[model samples]
Target chain A: MAKSVVEIKNLSKIFQRDSFSVAALESIDLDVKEGEFLCLMGPSGSGKTTLLNIIAGIDRPTGGELHVLGEDIATLSEDALATWRNVHVGFVFQTFNLIPVLTAYENVELPLLLTKLSAAERKEHVLMALKLVGLADRIDHYPRQLSGGQEQRVAIARAIVTDPTLVVADEPTGDLDAYSADEVLDILSRLNRDFKKTILMVTHDPRAAHHATVVRHLEKGQLLPVEN
Target chain B: MWRLVLKNLLRNKRRSFLTGTSVAVSLFLLSSLAMVYTALGKPLENADSIPIMMVRRATGIVFPMPASYGARIREVPGVAACASLSWFGGYWKDPANMFANLAVDPENVFKVQFASTIPPDQLEAFQRERTAAVAGRRLAEKFGWKVGDKITLLGSLWGFNPELTLRGIFSGGPDDQLWFHWEYLNEAIGRMNVVGLYWIRLEKPEMASRVGEAIDAMFRNTPNETKTESLSAFMLNFIAMLGNVRGIILLIGSAVTFAILLIVANTMAMSVRERISEAAIMRSLGFRPAHILRLFVGESLLLTLAGALLGIGGAKLLYDSLRLTQIGQFAFADLRLRPETLALCFGIALSVALLAATWPAYRAARTNIAVALRHTG
Candidate 1:
């Protein structure tokens, strides 16, 4: 049996604007195990992104018990949560949010700068991560210099450069073409299988869900039955 | 970190260059004017230390007094020495090419001022030779004068073109002037003892006002009544004649400094606003708020420092090449920028940079990662 890396019980999130209130997430319950590729699928406004953000430690639930890697992130302070995220969670976004000022190599080295790793060790880890994404040759290229697919590859390299315990991806392929989408999905799947990294991905595409080991659905921020 | 800042600047090279150039120009103007002000004001600061005071006609600086007033001023209590001075408005070659030309009692002018300045041998030679004159090193360099060279002064105060020999070149302690025997002018003008002003050296500097009152009391209600004041006071009179521009210097410096601050601050704010998504991504990557603050402020300071260096360097180049233009009374005659001016310029640059970075750094540091990520593309 795989060990549980993330545990959520009865999580709820409500946002208030002016005189109106909207529920972004409501009473979500789920569990993710080590090295599991769990894909969350749902309709457009089904709270998939909100749930993923909560699990990534970027946003906290209003009421719930949320734990990742044995640490209750809900109990952590903002700075502590940020530190935990640095060491434990990697993130991939739809638009490939790599700093445009930095080259592919420097962008990938961002997370490592927080650690005490020597320059040689950091360079070695970054090179290996880029190699895993099959972008070893594009290390010197900037985001504007690369294609949509190459930019996504560099972003994935940056995400995994810290060897995070979990990778949380939110609509990681929504903006890419069919071929570029497959390239990113291949990298996420490989990160799960070959590197044994736990992945919690939010996707609307059935083809992307096919690559996950276990698939789940969210309706109004509540998790449905999981299918293996 | 510096590389990151450099790369970010290069991202919008034109905008950075334009804003940086403005900072450079502001700093150049501010620093140059400050240098000039300090140079021009130093002599006034030292005026009280010198015991010598000039007793002029009570009417104003332009009015003349009798040469016999020198003897009466010397007899006054606390008066150590006195000498009569006559303005010798001489111009060489072109009438517009003016320099300091004066006629003094060669045997007595040294007893009051320029006493220890000239060599004893040169003073004796000046007293013995009526045609002999002395020039400053700067004047000599400007006109290429040797000790024995004879120069003729055309037109004016004495109403004669007096031909004189160069006797001695004195370092008037950061100043240069031409002085000759009063007898030479007397011989040309046919007036044996008429003069314009008298320089009175006090036994003690603290007795300036008291001694001044006594001298004016002796000559009061009579013709050729005198007004006595220190050298610094006279310099002030000279400055007033040229239209006191200290207020303008301060006003323009403050305006320019404020302008540069706004410009750099606006550029920084715009840059940060455009990088909202990037900052959010960094926050999501687990960079602390303090980290964000450092990056933003550090980038601004680096930008300002670059601009400041260019400005100061340009000013230095301008000063290095400046010569032959003299506008100051005494202190700022050369008008070169000093080390203190450079230090103050950099201080202002650093402080303004830090001040300009504050709001933008705070905004970037307090950015909400979730909201920013949701909104920005």
Candidate 2:
């Protein structure tokens, strides 16, 4: 009986384009317990990413209650939601979106900058995060100077540096080669298992989904239970 | 976060340099304009140090008042110094070599005006010689004359050859004119006396209006009545004759500042536009829209500050090397480009940069994350 980190009740999302209304999500009801590694698998336009965004508080559900860490997503201001997300949830994207200007340590050190941590404390935490991603040796390298796999590891370092309760990854390894993809999945698996971090990952690759403890399918705009 | 801002600048070298240049050029124009404005108006601001002219009440530029009033005006109260000066108009030794020449009282010349950098020995020598002249530094350099050399003026006003020895040459303050002895000239044509104008100096600045009134009132009912004015008023009267140069100068400053604002704004806008995808990525990394806004604004402010530093530095260098004698009467010697002025230019550049960044920042902040992801994908 673990505490639920995310709870969604009758959630739906609608997007308007020029002159047409498109439904991105419809009646998505779900509960995700703390420390559970859940995967949402679907094809393009299947609303998998949309559901992750809603649960992560990056997007609104248009109609219904989405409670992340006990706070309703709709009621939070944009600034409040951003601050909440920084402290409570971490995100990893398909593109290893490291700031090209900053070094590995600095990029990993960014989210901590928003906090009131002392410079020495920030450095210590940043070093530990990079070490966790096995990139402590390349702390001073710029994102452009790092390999694709190394850059993705730095992105991972940045994500976990804040020690957030929930981690949301959308197509996290979609841009990497097999070796890099495997390394990234292994790190994410370790984050969920060893660190006991709750992970909600959206992926189209079956092999990538296999690392998750539980897998859920999304078709068009509805969530379906995984078949045995 | 600031580290990221710094890295972004270095990563895109061409864009950063372009933005920096836009800010630098605007600052350069502003600095130069301020220097010129300060140079031109300096004498007017220090009017207490300079003297005024006494003109005939009804006489205009073409007419002349009797020379007898020069001696009579010397007797007025608060008039610590007085001298009569005939325009002597411009001297042309050759038709091509023309410059200012004035017939002035040798005895009272040193007594009046900001004496500038002339020694007492030279002034005494010039006065005792009777046929001597004290040439301005600029006029002496133009004719290549030494202290004892004789200069012959082919006078346009009196239409005579007034040969006089250059007893010494003295540098005058910003508003100096060349002078030769009036006694020497008037003696050459005795009883044919006529003083072009009388120059009077008051001992205290506050006494100027009172003395000016007394001088005019003393001869108010006289046959050769007079009109007297402060030197600043005379200079302003001359400046007024130019009809809208001051207004035009102000208009030009405004226009230049406006053009600079546009240049800065355009640079910031382009910088923001190119970083849309990057901004989207930042948001996905849990950076709020306000964070994105500050990054863009901070970058612009930094660019403008760099430009302002360069522009102000260049201006100070230019002002230092400049020989103002060749650039008309720049009434102040120290036409400096101040640090505060640089800060102000930086401030203006920064404001323009920030203003220019505002719209793009809004666009970046309110960006539809889903659409941005879709577009990038």
| Leading candidate by lDDT | 1
| Candidate 2 segments exceeding 4 Å error | A226-228, B49-64, B88-100, B114-125, B128-131, B137-144, B154-161, B170-176, B183-196, B216-227, B323-344, B373-377
- Provide a comma-separated list of chain B TM-scores, one per candidate: 0.83, 0.80
lDDT (Cα) of model 1: 0.84
User: What lDDT tens digits, residue by residue, belong to model 1 across residues B267-320?
Assistant: 899988888677778888888878777888888898898899999878988887
Q: Tell me the fnat of candidate 2.
A: 0.43
**What DockQ score does model 1 reach against the true complex?**
0.64
B1-377 per-residue lDDT for model 2 (tens digits): 67677766666788778767766776788877766555445435566655554444444534567777877778888788787777776564786666567788788766665555677888888888867878778767766777988778784656567887888778765324567878777877664677777777777767778888888888787666777887766555545556756576667767877886677678777777777777876676667898999898887777777887787677777766775535344243345655555566666667777787788878877786655665442
Whole-model Cα lDDT per candidate?
A: 0.84, 0.77
Question: Clashing residue pairs, candidate 2?
Answer: none
What's the number of clashes in each of the models? 0, 0
Query: Retained native contacts per candidate, as fractions?
Result: 0.62, 0.43
- The candidate 1 chain B region of ten consecutive residues with least summed lDDT is B323-332
